[model samples]
Target: MTTTTATYDPGLIDMTNEANKKIKVLLELRPALDGFAGIPQEVRLLFRGLRKIESVDIEGLLQTSHRRLARGTSDTGFFRKKISAARRYNRISNVIISMAEKPYRNVLDIIMDYFQKRAEVASLQISMVSGFGKIKLTRFESKSFEDFTWRTIFSKTLPASDFSLVAPANHRVCSVPWHTLHTVGLSTLNWRSTPKYPKLDTKGFDIFIGQTPYPARVDPDTAYVIRYHDAIPIFMPHTISDKSLHQATHFYAMMSNVKSGAWFACVSEATRQDLIRIFPEVTDRAVTIHNMVAHHYFLENSAFERVPGIIRSRLYEGDPSKGIELLPKFFSLREKENFYKRSLGDKHFKYLLIVSTIEPRKNHTRLLAAWEVLKADVDPDLKLVVVGTLGWEHSSITKAFSSWIDRGDLFMLNAVPAPDLRVLYRHAAATVCPSLGEGFDFSGVESMASGGITIASDIPVHREVYEDAAEYFDPYATMSLVKALKKVLYEEGAQQEQEQMRQRGGEVSSRYLPEQIIPQWERFAERVVAERKSIKSSTTTVFEEKNSSVSST
Candidate 1:
């Protein structure tokens, strides 16, 4: 195999006389507030890598999707304790919305809604503060960061590093929430008879990077860059939650960004092509920069004995306090004890593992069907283990698991930290990735990084990202998956096949490690800044020529 390196000229422009030579970047941190889910996890990884680049000055935009930020840069204690004022403001806003929804004079409702839009617009105009509600610009408490690091740091394959970097530092927040900006932008279409995107105050930053298609436009001097993940909402709408709203928000915001000439950094080549398919003109502005897998997953000599305890502790048994209950026929107290005890020592206990949200697009139902056949015919001792949070439209999928869950042939665990997840990946018979659609599925690569074999759906992204490292099966065909699993799990020469796949996976997964991916980003940042400078210089030269001609006339 041959590797090609793209030549990058870093000295595209002289910066010796520039007051600020470092490119100042403000990255939206809304995704970081969410749990260790897909986009959120990527945000953490991106921040970690960006901090290591010396030429870039990165700061986080400490704002929430729907919650208003309190004013001032002061002490924001742990647990976001300073959000009390923001909470009170939200209560008032909710009251206004509820009143508008009431049976009043149709005229009164219209008038109230109008006033609400005006207020929201006014709130968005608040000057940018270094922090939200007394939180210092460089130091504040983020429970989300705390939770993420706690789960992944100890579980990392490499020595735990960047502990302090994960905390809140060099961040700024706005008084108005991002949700309000979206609402206001949409409202302007009706209120003024023309759509108007809300403008954000990004005065000091050279570039402002958003996690997705942002609802607001940044200052003219600041270049807006969208870290485009995928077009899933547009292409696979039915599989996602809030189908209508999600599609509308994504489409409208995307259109606005395109019209404003924002740069797009796509997560995969497949995703970049999807974007081009919708808007052909954005081809010049969009580029693919694949996602980086965290350093938490790697080859480990973990014993199979640890699997049972991980399953027992992390299994998502419905909460009794919340009036939610698991199946009445689920493992009995004595039966569970024996099952755990037996599995703790049973070297023959083999389970197929999949880590993805239990959503329709993940193709969990199809995987379940294949697992059932594998268990019934090929290997009766085979078990299926699912590790992911329950997503919307998942009732049927969960229903399919009931019988298997009751019989102790299947297990479901949620919030298993990186440490336990690495162990699960290393010891699984094979990690299955049967997503019907994806921009870049992280699980298969993470499994490979952990010295595990992969069985993936033969989708374009999977083929491009996983290459020949995984056994490909048609996502729509249960029998196809069954055959693929059989060849890897129980067929003749299976051990040799698995070993070969693991070796290939190590090479493939290395392409996404931080060291390999960060250089791409650094070059991209430099090029964007250099291009902007070139454009500015050309414009200045044209203006000077026009002035000289006017003086001669």
Candidate 2:
């Protein structure tokens, strides 16, 4: 993965019309790397936000009408297959064509031809062909990114691509030549500004965007640009996946596949700092591009709506200072009602909400412990509403979750639909986020945008994202969280304070809006092309020198 390092700048990109500024791209993709069943939910959910404007067939609105069985599953996995089948084709046509009434889906166009296998990068360069995983490859055309998102949600297997990570609503990357691939699982969650480098067996495009590393001994001319998320695995070796060798590389590869000469688009300033800490020399090769929030879904306006009456009745509070009437413009009435019936079920008890993967790093155990103390004085009927699928090291909280559920003290909505989630956010007494670390803390921001009071772990990322908009607590101390929850829930004038906090939270969200993010991407694309050309010229000189030496020999 070694290469001649080059300078990278965040303020560079082709100034030509954005629509016309297309680069010859070679994406190194691993479509079937599984979060569960050969797919990374982060990348899949990203496609769900593609609007009709980005590309007509995107969202697969015009995908073939008839649905069939998914590639690998048998009749026993029928339910899962059915959900997958609907998502891959035709499911979102109505929503885009008829129901889409807002300009929220407007996003920057990212056009590229996708390659499903690592081998494809070589074949496409040398032979103009490649193969992909049978199960995941076929899904390229059949599976709709929009459908896969919610279907995975209902199936309770959706990986942790929370909206705050802002995949779909922010990006519009459409793989043009990708039409032929069956449906391979795209494993990357971020590729928006991944222009960076190394070598490959064959060469055409100077840059590549995908999960696979460049072939070990590649043509020095090939530049592999990787989307850098975090340096967590390198610093915290324990977090590295037991199944993969991606974290293991030589000197240049030690810190990352990122070598000296490649351009990288990091997800946050914090992430850029992580890269810099490992490779101080990479200061010029990396630039910080903050992650965006799906403001369209959580703020402004949304496609779904519930009746005002239903919302008013459910969120009824005699206090005038209570958070403003929940915005019904965002919820699907039927969906919200059904969710309520299933979760709340004829009960009118107030609830506190937490939306995130249930794992140790997320610090859910502490939240549970805090709730144990808070419930004693706060209202016995106040339910802890936990939303999200389980993640690794969840055994620590399994007993706690089970005991609470069994005692009817908590409601576990593992993977509710987007609309139902918005409903919960709007009506909940307040949302809690007690994570220990994160590349970005979307839950806190999302809770605020959804008009819920957010009490977050006083982590740097949370402070960066929520600032004074949220009530902060020491994540390590259950008492701190208990106190914060108490102040937001039981303390007098809490409603007015929360309502004001929600407004400030809305203001904070503006920074992560897509408008604020798109310019960073445009500049990133520009620098990538400029650097590639510069390195390619250097490679040409090397070739000329080699030829002269051969002639003399």
Candidate 3:
């Protein structure tokens, strides 16, 4: 086998093209390979890789085995043959291999070094301002973000966390040692003056992460990383308002600045892609890092079996044999009758659980309608348990829910304990989420984690996370949702499908575990810091050069 060294032409591929832009950036940042050099080892490896391509006959190379070479999987024989062929064509082998052994050292170094640097950083400060305390930044404050300084503020309008504080806490708030906390309930302040107005000093912090990009308190110079949870405004156009429009524009602007400055992290790739589609300019800087669940939340088999007596008692209070009417003040006569029948036997009623606030975005009304359609065909013993507090300006939903309450098929638990919710997920025949939109459907994932088959909306984000594991249905299609629900409840292979979903859920759950996701967070923070430093260095160099030139003149 003769050696065929092909003359490599870098120009054959326009590095500036959108397809190769990311690679181009990587190559541009490539470091020189010198152990005694001032540049980082990682950068050195990157430079070595880029130096290998010399010159080439673009068209001729393409006509030969260029495609395979482009793929970076060409065999030694193929490489040798190319070299020999190039020699025959009177083409000089311009490709250099002086530092080929250290080809990818710099790129890997950049990534690893960033992670290492993030771990070294003294502390992180995050500010969470959202309608609901659902994202409860404080929850993670004890674990993943525990080492970081945290500040949280919530809208007083939203509902509070269901459970009370646990006693003898293993984790203390003061673990962070340095934190400036505030609760600006429902107060909307000017974005520009927020830092000074709130007396944050603003200079001490490394990064500011928040739900709203245009927080009244974020300093311009601070690294602002915004959370893009859901496209609720887009998915439900009616939800859009002037305030929302301002928030969206500010979010886009903040994203652009962050991308140019440090880096921006998104909860999911689907969300990151959506953000890119809406604001194409920030595509280069956006990264996906999954949200995490606390370890203590994972209930054991015994814990699952040990349903709180309070929950079981509340669920089954009346004696069916004695014809006793035991009812809560919230239940109507029809609901009371249904509860009476469901409580008749010693055996508990299996439920098809749907847990989400009864908001339009959640599409609860449609789910209820779908459930009604399936009720006639399915077993009467199995109930549709809709658990959540009433939410927002949904009068029609409230009225419909009242009507459902009159019927015997639906059971509504206004609020339940988290452990009880977990039991619901574990025991339910299937958990259905017929939402029109979701940033990250916590309920759906929770159900999956608890070994329940999830029937979710067929949306891009859902598909990205669940992949082929979930039984997807179009939210707009009532028949599709009804069919899926029916299949989950009554199909012949339903048990096997549920088991498969349970396994998939377990696999997917790993990504959300604190142990798995915290390291990724650390890596992301490090990259942002390094990238910011690089940008600052370039700016300083330009400024110094201009100053020197002026002095010389």
Q: Which is the leading candidate under lDDT?
A: 1
RMSD for all candidates, in order, please. Answer: 7.7, 13.7, 22.2
Q: Which candidate is the best by TM-score?
A: 1
Task: Write the residue-wise lDDT of candidate 2 on 1-553 in tens digits.
Answer: 1112222344344444246434444433224222321123323322332221131112111111112211222223313445455433342332233222311221321111122334444433332212211211122332334344343221222334543222232111221123222111111113312222222322333445443222222234545555565565566545334413334421224333554355656655666676678778867777766555554236434322342223334342112263322112225779656655554553456777888776677788898888888778667777777776556665557656766664545655543544556667777778888987666666666667676688899976677667788899999999999889888778998878877887887877676666666555555555666666677788899999999999999
lDDT to native, each model: 0.75, 0.50, 0.46
- Please report the TM-score between candidate 1 and the true structure: 0.83
TM-score for candidate 3, residues paired by index? 0.58
Residues 153-237, candidate 3, lDDT per residue (tens digit)? 1111111330111111111111111112121211223342222112122232344444423222333344545544544554455
Off by over 4 Å in 2: 1-21, 26-206, 211-223, 239-256, 299-348, 538-553
What is the alpha-carbon lDDT of model 1 when measured against the actual structure?
Answer: 0.75
Q: CA shift at 482, candidate 3, in angstroms? A: 1.9
What's the distance in Å from true for residue 54, model 2? 8.7
List residue ranges in candidate 3 displaced over 4 A: 1-200, 216-221, 240-262, 296-299, 302-346
TM-score of 2: 0.61
lDDT of 1 by residue, 1-553 (tens): 2221222233443333156578888888777765664788888788778878888888777667776543333344334455565644443333333322432335854675567456544554431111111112222234334443334322122234666555433455554567766775666556444345667667777888898888877776788789999999999998799898888788878888888788898888888889989989988778888889888888989888788889888888755585544433435799767765654447658899999988899999999999889878988888889998878877788878887777777888887888889999999999999999998899999999999989999988898889999999999999999999989878899999999999999999999999998987787787777677778789999999999999999
lDDT of 2: 0.50
Error of 3 at 352 (Å): 1.2
Cα TM-score per model: 0.83, 0.61, 0.58
